[model samples]
Target: MANVTAKDAMQIHGRNPQHLVEKIIRTRIYDSRYWKEDCFALTAESLIDKAVELNYCGGIYGGNIKPTPFMCLLLKMLQIQPDKEIIVEFIKNEDYKYIRLLGSLYLRLTASSQDCYKYLEPLYDDFRCIRVKNRSGSLVRGHVDEFIDDLLHEDRVCDVILPRVQKRYILEETGEIQPRVSAIDDLLEDDEDTEKESDDELATSTRDQ
Candidate 1:
């Protein structure tokens, strides 16, 4: 990892580096009244529930609609002061695509460009069939890497602004890759009521078909 810092990148964007959370929230607009009614001041830890319930991954869930829980949780991670180690752990755990998606999003937003390339490049082979919403307002199947490709290369993926991550070799000189701490080991799926919508339950329309 180079000595690249998030603050430097954030400064180039001309926004206060500390207020990245506000940027995420202000940039997105979701039609789910549930979101408007809720989703304010949610801690990064609290957003895990929503991320787990997110069964699909896509830039858009419907026509002109906002991103899904995968994106929302990523945004929330930015909001609630996430621990990079914990988020990296999420990326390594392949049990759930949405969780990994959240981790990937975190890295894209805050990790060094070198770290992003080192970690995310290999996931290009992940051919898991997750659900996505197409432009004609149809639900369809897509691969995880297909989404990752755009995220790695494009300035904005999933209609979210991403600060350019420069390479960071500074950390390497310190001779210690930060030890991974278990910040979220206790986050088990206990909320049975919040179980994700099944594939059969998912409809062609994000709101209503």
Candidate 2:
């Protein structure tokens, strides 16, 4: 891990970097009312139920579905900011195509170059079919390969803007890139404390008034 270099990552991934254009999907996501829902407080354990109940992890059959759950869930991921570990866990699970797709999308949006390549490169080989809505508002069948390819090469996929990744560079002295700090545990704690404090303050103010 510490000894791994950028060259090693590239050699392992073999995905030569390229500049890509941002897709129009971003606009569509923003325009959808359901995408604006607050999902920041959801936990890894809690999200599974919501994913299932919302019918987010299944295939779309018709064009009439409004406020598509998958897109809404993807937007929720951006808002909630699940850490790398949770995202990776989602990717590793073989149960649901939509869950894995969410993981891949989250990684592309937030992971470092090395982490992205390390986790998502393997998903390119996943041939599972996922039904998606196209620009013409028609339900279409698309495979995992198509989704992963667009995420790898295009700046935006499924209406999300991916941050530009810095080229992998190795310090000759360190011999490895530093791993990103994980904040999921801390985020849960902080959010809980913040909510409690807000509730207390609201009660106190209301009593005084």
lDDT of 1 at 75: 47
After the best TM-score superposition of candidate 1, give how far the Cα of residue 121 lies from its true spot, in angstroms: 1.8
| Stretches > 4 Å off in candidate 2 | 1-41, 53-67, 166-209
Q: What lDDT does the true structure give each of the candidates?
A: 0.60, 0.59
lDDT of the structure predicted as candidate 1: 0.60
lDDT per residue (tens digit) for residues 81-110 in model 2: 555688888888888777888788767766
Best by TM-score: 1
Model 2 C-alpha RMSD to native? 19.8
What CA RMSD would you report for each candidate?
A: 17.8, 19.8
Question: Please, what's the RMSD in Å of model 1?
Answer: 17.8
Q: How many clashes in each candidate?
A: 9, 1
On lDDT, the candidate that comes out on top is 1
